[model samples]
Target: MPSSHLRAAFVLLLLLLSGCEQEAQAPLDQQLYIWQRQWRPAHAEALADSRADFSTLRVLAAQAHPGAGWSRIQVDRELLAADGRPLVAVVRLDGQLPDLDLQRTRADILALVDHWRVQGIVMQGLEIDHDCASARLLGYRDFLRDLRRALPADLRLSITALPAWLDSPVLADLLRQVDASVLQVHAVSAPENGLFDPARAQAWAKRWNDASDRPFLLALPAYGIALVNGRVESESPLAIAGPRRELQADPQQLAELLANLRRDRPEHLTGVIWFRLPLPGDRRAWRLSTLQAVARGEPLHADIRPDIQQSGPLHEFALANLGNLDGPLPERIELPARSCDAADALAGYRLERAADRLVFTRLNEGRLAAGQQRALGWARCEHLDQGGSRVYP
Candidate 1:
């Protein structure tokens, strides 16, 4: 072809590529991780509330430790089956495990699959949540390969990948064995840096997309943690008592990241799988309404209302959050009441009683989850009205 014609052809090709890059992608698929070790009565309600926004349920089935034998959580098969969503049984191998007991692990997973089948809950996939060191990627890859071969051909296999593996040379080989990978971008490091850095997470996603050939999901944080005396406290039954600093995943930041990812989605980047499903009584996790709204890439706001309940002379002061976003606890609550008897604040606040008004100053910042009410203080006043009650954020 002539020089002019060839140049025109090259420009046309560039235009086509640019158009493809700018084309809007479909909304990413969202999944939920039911990571509770023990099933609860609240799980039913949580599932019902999050049904619309999420498409898949990744239930934690079994966990294996180094010396301690593995334990299993008995999920309500009937409840899960009735929900009618695709279920993925997740088996977690503790990173501290010295070696992978390939045969035993496979046997246990097959047993759980059989158990669920008998209970009429068909599992669509199996995900291995192992945060192995980058050096062990080869061994982990071999384990996944063996397990994949042992399982039924129809049952999909996946792994929960770590950001640490980005530097490993074998990441591609490891990803090749699984049908998909869930890149955990939250709580990957020490708690001092905070959980879920939006900029770092987005950069990691871009790098992971370039590295993996299979479809992958980002495991984002929808919860917070308490660091007490350098010990991290998550959603566990054990309570560590000390002065604790709270680190939470900001909803607005996460929403903005999701919006950006949606606008310029990476190749093979499927969607996000939130860290854990939030129950109504879960203090560390965000509210179900908040999680759902965040998943939908919607704007967020916290509605903190001052709630004053009275019975005769005894009046109770509380703050109720009626919005869809969980946020920092209010710094102060001011109430206009003339009391003759007494007034006291709750554990998180200190009371300063003035002649005309009372102030409940926050001692420490805590999370007031959406759709929840927190008691601040109580007062035995002759007459207390809600007119001048105000909550400061």
Candidate 2:
């Protein structure tokens, strides 16, 4: 697309966005995506708080295709805090709209809602996250209208909307059917393209904020998709390999995006919600501190610490980085080795006879970012026991 066309489209979006900052701002919250058949809380200290409005729970995905089965998300009662925060039950619809049995899907959702309602859980809202194709916008709109009418009047009805829906003729009709909608502007990307396009996201937020008097929330990704650069198959340094790991969200990026959103947010903007809440050890997740930094729009620096433990006949160590910035996995570290330390005491460290310090040179090239930690090399320990402390100067 030409720059001029992009600019023109942006201007058009500005014209499309409705009402000035209106009343009734919604509280910001994080999503809890439970793909696990069962779940347990890993970090209660970080997760249990008023900061979260509601934990959007995925009740299940209704597979309305010819011979499909239900994929449910069941959580253990002990896993969550009953601190009065509601659960926004979300029913995801799978398969193509053309192939889907909308009636069956609607019936499945109602069953789920009633199931929850009878349980007496504190649930004030029910949302659907469906990426219905653009051509199926009308069908999606119709399905929502039916679903809204069928649902109890008290429960808030919302849908996770795709950017494609914004330009569709059915956008207004779709809005009229639901109590609210969330514009998910963050899409997976090539590293160069990034997980989010702030300009594009801001434009869409404005567009939706203006298009609907109904409540609107601009959803941003609090996670990252790691796209590794360079490949063995392609010699080019810039060649990106398809191999990827789910990169945890960077606190810096989140802070930056929140800052930008504040500037571009329209009058009708309710609040922002993260893609999902992250649990400890989740490969594709943000550190709890990272999420906190994002919520606060602040930069956090990294602090590195080393812990040593006795392993078999040798000593083992772990390096931890707790700061926000990636740094200080220093180029050279000196371990105060005891004279009783074996000659081969620290295998990876270069020993200085006169200095008596275990010198870590090559390992210093390592960079440890905040909220991450890893194993550090260890070696023979003579008379010393495990959990021994050595000072680093």
Candidate 3:
């Protein structure tokens, strides 16, 4: 063939390739993880809201290697029947064994899959949550390869990954065997430091994307952990991930992250999954509205107010936040009561008595969010100066 003809053919091919474009994906979808033992009311409500693309449930028991032998976690059959919604099964294994019992492990995993299949639960995919150490990634890879081969060809397999794994060559080798992963960028705790660092998470996401070609979903922390003062307690290490800190994600911060991830989203990037969908009683975790607001990248403003209503000798007091943001108990709140005589305290409230006023330093494990009105204790005051009360954030 002539050189000119060859060049013309190559040019035509290039033009055809350029003309065909990858379809644009919709604004990244949202996924929710239900990691609790009992199905909380929040799960039902969130699903009813139709917010999440799919809800992943933890089915299999946690995996471990105790006494240098393989151990399997008992499956949580709480979610026995699928609610006819798109459901995914999660198998969580948290153990450090010098050597894995690959054959037995594979069998156990396959059995778990079969159990779910036998039941009415229709799974769209399987997600394995294992925090394997960096040194053991090769073995992990082998396990994954065997697991993939064992699973049905139709069921996609995914796993939870650490940000540090992004740089490891074994991660590249491992992801080849799985369908997708959830990059959890929360709970990297340090003393006197925040649990979820947005900047670090964003950087890690970028690196993870560049490190591999696998489709991945970003796992952001929607819950907060309390930091135990390890320094004072010599027995514990510095900054342990707590005894339940009400430190949850702020919607504004979450909104920022959602927008950032969407902007930096690669073609293989799947969607965003909250570390959890919390129950209504979780004062430290985000509510469904906050999650929705974050997904929409909207700013959350709060206007919390304390009101007192009087009916003769009896008084009705309420602490409420009329704004969108979920406001927790501020550092302190002061009431007009000057000692117990002028304004006798009621029994229902947990308020402290200061030098001249009744102060409130905290709530009874509750947050001041929109639509959440707490009925504060009533005092016997007919003409109390409302101006004497104040609140500080």
Best by lDDT: 1
Q: Judged by TM-score, which candidate is best? A: 1
List CA RMSD, all candidates.
5.1, 11.1, 7.4
lDDT of 3 by residue, 47-149 (tens): 5563344444433333544563434444333433434545667766664555667887778778867877776457788888888887889989999998999
Estimate the TM-score for candidate 1.
0.85
Q: Write the per-residue lDDT of candidate 1 for residues 1-393, one digit (tens) a residue.
A: 999999999999999988876565556899999998888888888899889899999999988988777888889887998899999999988998887777888898888778877878888999999989988889888988888888889999989989999999999988899999999999998789888899999999999999978999999999989888888888774465678787889889999999989877888898899988988677788888888888887779889878888888898888888889876788888888886389999899999988778899999967777888888888998856579877788
Residue 363 in candidate 2 has what lDDT?
Answer: 33
| Candidate with better lDDT, 1 vs 3 | 1
Whole-model Cα lDDT of every candidate shown, in order: 0.87, 0.62, 0.68
lDDT per residue as tens, model 2, 230-333: 32221123345466433444556666666766665577666777766666665555566666666766666777766667755476656677665555565544
Q: Find the 10 residues in a row with the least total lDDT in model 3.
A: 229-238
Worst 10 residues of 2 by lDDT: 229-238
Q: Residue 118 lDDT in model 3?
A: 75
| Candidate 1: residue 258 Cα off by (Å) | 0.7
User: Total clashing residue pairs per candidate?
Assistant: 0, 8, 1
